[model samples]
Target: MIKKAVRMKLYPGLKEEYAKRHNQLWPEMKKMLKDHGAKSYSIFFDPETDYLFGYLEIEDEERWAQTANTEINRKWWDFMADVMETNPDNSPVTVDLEQVFEL
Candidate 1:
């Protein structure tokens, strides 16, 4: 499996709402991630800086790429656009982080 890390910016003062949305995450979205080889996905938020960190492991690059094109993901992006920095397409403005070291 390959570990992926990404970062994005969240709007200030929406920590609770962000957490609430994920707590009640759409079942289809979760299923899509798993079906695409994603495992142990998790996100962390830093309220002070409005920075969001996401991590996940995936075994297949092709499947992982397909996950981003799903309709459910597009809907989820639209649902979250109001609370985070997003592109015109409503996808979160994410920056993939390079791994410098691994134990």
Candidate 2:
């Protein structure tokens, strides 16, 4: 599996709302992610900065990327747009992190 990480910023004071939404992630959305090759997915938050760090292992990067275009994923993005930084398409504004060192 390929390990990946990305950084995303959240709107101020929406931490609880953000977590609430994710805690109730749609079943279809979760299945879509796994179908597209995602595994061991996790997200972390830094309360002080309102920044989110997402990590996941995937079978293939290209396949995982396809998850963004899925209907369930799009709905999830729209649901989250109001509480976080997102593009015009309602997709989260993310910056991929490079892996520099690992043991």
Candidate 3:
């Protein structure tokens, strides 16, 4: 398994709405993630900077990347574009983080 971390920016003043959306995440999206090799996933927010930090463990990077092409994933991205910094395709503007140490 591989551990991945990424950073995303949430629009100012949309924290509650973001949480509410995730809290009611669609079942199809959740299933798609699990099917695509997400063993564990979590997202943390920093209210001060409106930054969202995401972490996930996956079976393989190639398998994980394939998730992006799924219809459900695209829909999910579109669903979240309003509350996040996203690219033209509505995918979140994410910055992958490198891990320097682990305990």
User: Where does candidate 2 stray beyond 4 Å?
Assistant: none
Clashing residue pairs in candidate 3 (N, C-alpha, C atoms within 3 angstroms):
none
| Whole-model Cα lDDT of every candidate shown, in order | 0.93, 0.93, 0.96
Query: What ordering of candidates by lDDT runs from best to worst?
Result: 3, 2, 1
Error of 2 at 73 (Å): 0.7
Per-residue lDDT tens digits of candidate 2, residues 11-62? 9999999999999988998899889988789999998999999999999988
lDDT of 1 by residue, 1-103 (tens): 8899999999999989999999999999899989999988999998789999999899988889997799999999999999999999999999999999989
Worst 10 residues of 3 by lDDT: 59-68
- Kindly list the per-residue Cα lDDT of model 3 for residues 1-103, writing each as its tens digit: 8999999999999999999999999999999999989999999999899999999999999889999999999999999999999999999999999999999
lDDT, residue 44, candidate 3: 99
Residue 94 Cα positional deviation in candidate 3, in Å, after optimal superposition: 0.3
| Residue 95 local lDDT, model 1 | 98
